[model samples]
Target: MLKNFNWKDESGFTLVEMLIVLLVVSVLLLLTIPNIVKQSKSINDKGCDAFITMVQGQAQAYQLENNKVPSLQDLLAGGYLKGEQKKCPNGKDVQIDSSGKVTEVR
Candidate 1:
């Protein structure tokens, strides 16, 4: 029976090959996951910066129209900014100073 079996006709991957493939995939994931996390933080920071700029522009517009510096509440109450716009995308609250300058809470 052993003499009649053919050893050269195997059509599937061996255990070693499968384990190598899995190791490669795991290494790729390890390399990419940290990059993804770093990018997410960067994106959030940029988004918050953009939000601050927009709010600053709106504050300037409000000042031009009203002839006075507007607070954060004033912008919200006057409909220049929506309620949700009071905060940055990163969950930081925005504030408008007496000079109509917009800034993050911290």
Candidate 2:
């Protein structure tokens, strides 16, 4: 009778294969991180624009009805906006001073 050998062999990934996988994963992460950052910036910028538009629209409406410049308190009291206080709604505030220039108070 022929002798039979049946032993289980352990398997594991080689060092080069492991290193290749690690390098590939790192490269993919590097590629994806920038895109994620850009997308996040885009979202913030869009939100800021929308908030500015809402504020300006309400201010214009108040001015039209009153036939004069509208104050922040006036807008808050007139129910043109939901909040009792005026805020840019994106971690900012609408800045309108004695001059006509408006900026987002970040």
Candidate 3:
């Protein structure tokens, strides 16, 4: 059976072919990684902005109910916002000014 087997009939990828495939994959990754990072940052920024808007709305509601501008602590204590919601989604703290305007800490 060994004698009948033909070595030339077998086909397989050569080292150069494998290297080329690896190189292609590496190049693709390099191209996509930076864009992915940028998109992630953009998503975080948008999420933070939306979070601020929601918190601002809640603060306004609190002001309307109490007839006064509320501080961040007041919002938390009055049950207008949960404790976990004191910070933006990006881990930035949100502050309520005397005018009840919500701003994210830089």
Candidate 4:
């Protein structure tokens, strides 16, 4: 069997074929990356919106307990918030209005 083996019969991709495959893969990646980024941004926006809604609920609860709207710092100090204040993934800070409306500061 070894004697019958022929080196030229062993086949694999040629340089040009390998280059074509690499080019196709590169093109696919280039097309996919932007969509992935867009999806990530959309997810972040949704997450930020949900986060604002949750914070607003917490603010409302604090208002009910204290009979006045509280600032973000006050909420944190009073143990209404569990951790450091959160910001939008788009780099906006969460803010509270006089009426306890939570929003992202542009």
Candidate 5:
């Protein structure tokens, strides 16, 4: 039976088949990449928002403890903040105002 088998007659993917598959993959990537980028931006924005909220909370706690609003440097100096300043995942920096409110600067 092995001797009778014809390997020459076995078929592989045609050039057109390969090209079609490549076209489909390319189209899928083209369609998917933009959505993925959008989703990543959205996730980063949400993460940054949460970070800003946490920083604001810390600043508020600091103000309550010290009986006055604290600047970012003061927070860092007082060990209320882990760092001198924090940069958001979206490349924005957290800003602390005189009232201890937190904002973001892109």
Candidate 6:
């Protein structure tokens, strides 16, 4: 009979499967995004602190020897500071004055 070839047994996915998949993906995304953001912020802070330390150390060493803070570029040129001398972590230019003050050049 024609009924023998019926498609009555065919069924699409139930709502439960769709919801579960969506929930799992959403939870994973929520958990991952915050961690990524936190790590980026932490890295930025650490870099800024490092540059600050270098500038201070150079200033102190210069004052102890020459009785004044060295010129910003002089610190690097004289082999006191190591690493890229121009860029800070937040995209600011690291510039120090003769007064041992660090200011963003840009």
lDDT of 1 by residue, 1-106 (tens): 3656578985889999999999999999999999999999889889999999998998989999999999888888999888657887778888887777888998
Better of 2 and 3 by lDDT: 3
lDDT digits (tens) for residues 1-106 of candidate 2: 9966554454678899999999999999999999998898788778888877777777788778888676677777888767654554356667655432346876
1-106 per-residue lDDT for model 6 (tens digits): 3556557787877799999999999999999999999999889878887877777777678778877677767777777777557677867777777578776675
Backbone clash count for every predicted candidate, in the order shown: 0, 0, 0, 0, 0, 0
lDDT per residue for candidate 4 within 1-106, as digits (tens), equals 3678788999998999999999999999999999999999999899899888888888988999999998999889888787886677666799998978898987
Q: Lowest lDDT 10-mer window, candidate 6?
A: 1-10
What is the lDDT, from 0 to 100, of the residue 78 in candidate 2? 84
- Compared with the true structure, what per-residue lDDT tens digits does model 5 show for residues 1-106? 3667688898999899999999999999999999999999999999999989888988989888989988778888888778545778888888887767899985
- TM-score: the better of candidates 3 and 4: 4
Highest TM-score model number: 4
Candidate 4 Cα errors over 4 Å, as ranges: 1-5
Candidate lDDT (C-alpha), each: 0.88, 0.73, 0.88, 0.88, 0.87, 0.77
TM-score of 5: 0.78
Measured on C-alpha atoms, candidate 4 has an lDDT of 0.88
On a 0 to 1 TM-score scale, where does candidate 3 land against the true structure?
0.81
- Candidate 1 segments exceeding 4 Å error: 1-10
lDDT value, candidate 6, whole model:
0.77
Report the CA-based lDDT of candidate 1 relative to the real structure: 0.88
Candidate 2 segments whose C-alpha is farther than 4 A from its true place: 1-23, 84-90, 98-102
RMSD of each: 4.3, 5.2, 2.4, 2.0, 2.5, 6.0
